[model samples]
Target: MADLRTTNPDPASPYPLDPADVTPAGPPRAGAGVGLAVPGRATGERGFVPPASLADFAGLARAALPAEVWDFVAGGSGTETTLAANRAALDRVAVLPRMLAGVDTPSTEAALPGGRFALPVAVAPMAYQKLLHPDGEVGLAAAARAAGVPYVASTLASTPVEDIAAVGGTVWFQLYWLRDRGMVADLVGRALAAGCAGLMVTVDVPVLGRRLRDVRNGFALPPHVAAANLPGGRDDLAHQGTPGVSAVAVHTGAVFAPALSWADLAWLRERTPVPLLVKGILDPRDAVRAAELGVDAVVVSNHGGRQLDGAPGSAAVLPEVVAAVGERCAVLLDSGVRGGTDVLRALALGAAGVLVGRPLLWALAAGGRAGAEAALALLAAELRDALILSGCADPAAARELRTLIGG
Candidate 1:
């Protein structure tokens, strides 16, 4: 039986990154990249060893990315109060472990409306990944496919849907609700045609957040990076205007649909063929409404605390929404999910699964495909270990464990 115990890794030591963690260690599948024990530094890279701690990837990403790009990826809106709260809320939930129960090799598997997960973790979408590494979404998708997890490709991805799909395996497309319905339908059509199993429509960000870091850093995409999926290309999202104002905010004002309503979402539901998930829901009432609209899932998110500084972390509100609609539709979460214990905590709180954001981006930036793949492997390992210690065999048992909320 596999040992279901894990300890925090030394920040300096290379994690026990086995080839089977994210790569096909035994036999190569079509385009799975060098399946080996080498965790840090993908093929043809130099002097980078994968770190054990997911938090350590941040320094590597910072060193690899330009200041503005880092700010764009890492910074939140306003004072980032909600950003801090996101992590703090996760820390507040204390898991009461059940010892001496016959549990070994605990299962980390999860079932979502999208598909089966080897573990209840999904890659949350972030924009302009090309800036992180040349592999971008293609590399990330390959890693996720190898890990048996879902990858949510951003609408603002530097790679096109067709190119992303060409990497093989079904993916989930994240849509931003662009102003034109024709364009919206077109993007959805392309995503569906490209074999995306799910459509994650982000209902937050009627306007982009006031990320002071981006403003201070004068963040702008390099000339080479452009929205690959958008026809005719978009100069707006790729460029920065003025030094102090948020370029993203300006872009959202001109490009996104602020007046969007539940009716508009209902319209989208009617047209979309794959499983549809609403990506931002803080209120249980709103969750109920989305379930009533027959959405396959409602992702409990505060846009990773990027849109509203005042809002609470998604985990803080997870249970209420789950209670309201857990039976009606799947409930997922995003924002401030750092490690497997966090995933365990979320499952215990009634989240069907948790979407990880910044950590994987850091991995992609630091180690490209290898780093991204290792991120999921690390989390899955941790979740499995946690389940064994807690005497839970699977995600359903995880939901029934004793939980104490507080410091």
Candidate 2:
């Protein structure tokens, strides 16, 4: 495979980049860019240069973090078949560019239940962000504020909900249905009090999938990175005194409701007046059912390939889910989204929007607050180029663009 690093022949030029120099490698770095960072940009005190692409961010994050932490962030369930499939599906999609349309500007704004966003992207919920950086969710929230996108706070967030809310951005709360109803109620109330715009109930992770990397690395949350949102600020520990088992695994078993059903969703809907979204719906039937149950939206996800090892890629299943419920409600996607062109393809394939996960985490690990901001900026910039090239003058019009499969 070709080297995926983003380099510059002459670091001064900002425009009219060489096409040969900017092209990605093979399947591994399919959506990554090369040498896209402009020279003489602001740098962090540590001389941290912003990454040029999502792949660059991933490399930096891997180099900076501990082996266990990197594995936890990057690893997928079982053989990681679904993880690879997500990228493979995206790689197969080819945009059919239109020429001489006289389109000068491409608008990226997209509408959600509460408001319109600058792009059709939102920060997907991820657990234990503090493990990656000191700034944690607070840093991510600030970055999301700067990027004009929503930040979905995970149920297992390292920072407290109130602190993240204080950042004053478009925030959504992602809930992992807990066994205790009272605990669930408390979390819901806290999120609402903190000014969250919507509630995304994650239904896929009834039990944590067996992640081989975490098992081999013996990964567990450090003492500092506790799930602050949980009652008593508990961490995911296997047991108070267990020596061998992973704490996260133990926590997953104790908190998540294994028997959760659609009826429980109705119960949740009754409790929160905010827009309720059912996340991790890969099946068209589930998408239809979620909409029928009064969900404001349904997120088409395979839990970022972290659950169900053999499941189809989120992108592979997106078109069917969109067809099932596009008229009934919004159909957002998440899994292996790398950059703007991938976003464009997803829109063309019928996703209303997408939720980005690992790339932001990689950014946080690479350069903390500044890295996260730079990552979002890079994606937005790329999206603009993609829209102009794909013959869409506006992001909303991306839905009408044609896609050639197996490109």
Candidate 3:
């Protein structure tokens, strides 16, 4: 296993998603993903053409996976208004580039509350990966390791978090904030013991958003898949639904603590020694409160439009959140992050880094580990191009970029 966390297990490094690299480097940036093997295409792999773009991966994955599975992956909460808004919000942000600033070979490396990564992006936590492809989270983590990025293993990951951590890269565990504090505490202990670099507490889903498509499709995990980390290997996450009701919403309403609040967040902050990040902050006040409570970071997200059908896109709310807590804690953004330009937009808006969601899954479903690597490489290359063109020499410099909304 990569000793990135082993070497610096107590990663309470100040959140540095700011205009400068002001955050303290907790320890020598652990080998910068040294143990993860970089992948190269082999000639013997038959008929597999690497994806030229994320959309290409989406196309391939759509055709390859079952329609029900695709719906489960692609569908969102009622009316999907928030889902479409996520992409539209990203589309509205335009970067105004500088002339003759002589920036070239812009370094994509960025530091977050967890660790520095090859790019300013990490994989967003999603669950039950085996349903997407047989290789699942393990394969995806290997690819992320190879690309020098962090993988936020989901609470509902098909494989155990310990196994995912063993894949030899920086792994952060995404906790779902279950009603049982003891159960939650045990999960945290397991992740820390397994050498996870950080613990991100997802605070959005007090109850699962009612997804209409899942209701119409009546989706559920196949017999072979289960949430491996839960005691007794129980898979309680509501992955799908029935004709009239969203099973996920119903189960979530019960299994998860609908009463989860700021006090609960405070409890979590005290429970774990690792860098604690609070995910699902759209309001500036919430961001401020989290920062005040000693949170190392906050992920501004709408759960990839999977929850809260009417909520604004993460990009739309990012600037305000950063303005609220950018100086106090790291602010990360997710939702509708389809390309490198989006990453640039997030940074320009004051996010320390961005968490990529569905595109990586599309790549994984399209071509397994190699596909995921290809996706990250494509994003990194595109981010470098955007930075160079805009004369931003490093990821942090993008913070000073001038942007116009609705351009």
TM-score of each: 0.87, 0.88, 0.86
| Candidate 1 vs 3: which has more TM-score | 1
Put down candidate 2 lDDT per residue, 1-407, tens digits, no spaces. Answer: 12323222123523232121123322232222111111122374434466666655666664455555666777777777787788888888887888887887889999866779999999999998888888789988899999999999999998999899899989999999898889898999999999999999999999998876566555677777788898774553632424445568778888888988989998998888988888999989999998998898899899877899889988888889989886888989898888898899999999889999988987887667778888898999889999999888877789888877787
Off by over 4 Å in 1: 1-48
TM-score ranking, best first: 2, 1, 3
Clashing pairs in 3: none
RMSD of each: 8.9, 8.1, 12.0
- Model 3, 76-145: lDDT tens per residue? 7777778878888888899888889888777889998767888888889998887766678998899889
Alpha-carbon runs more than 4 Å astray in model 2: 1-42, 45-48, 236-244
Error of 1 at 151 (Å): 0.6
Once model 2 is optimally superposed onto the true structure by TM-score, how far is the C-alpha of residue 310 displaced, in angstroms? 0.5
Q: Higher-lDDT candidate among 1 and 2?
A: 2
lDDT of 3: 0.76
Of the two candidates 2 and 3, the one with more favorable TM-score, higher being better, is: 2
Ranking by lDDT: 2, 1, 3
- Model 3, residue 39: distance off in Å is 16
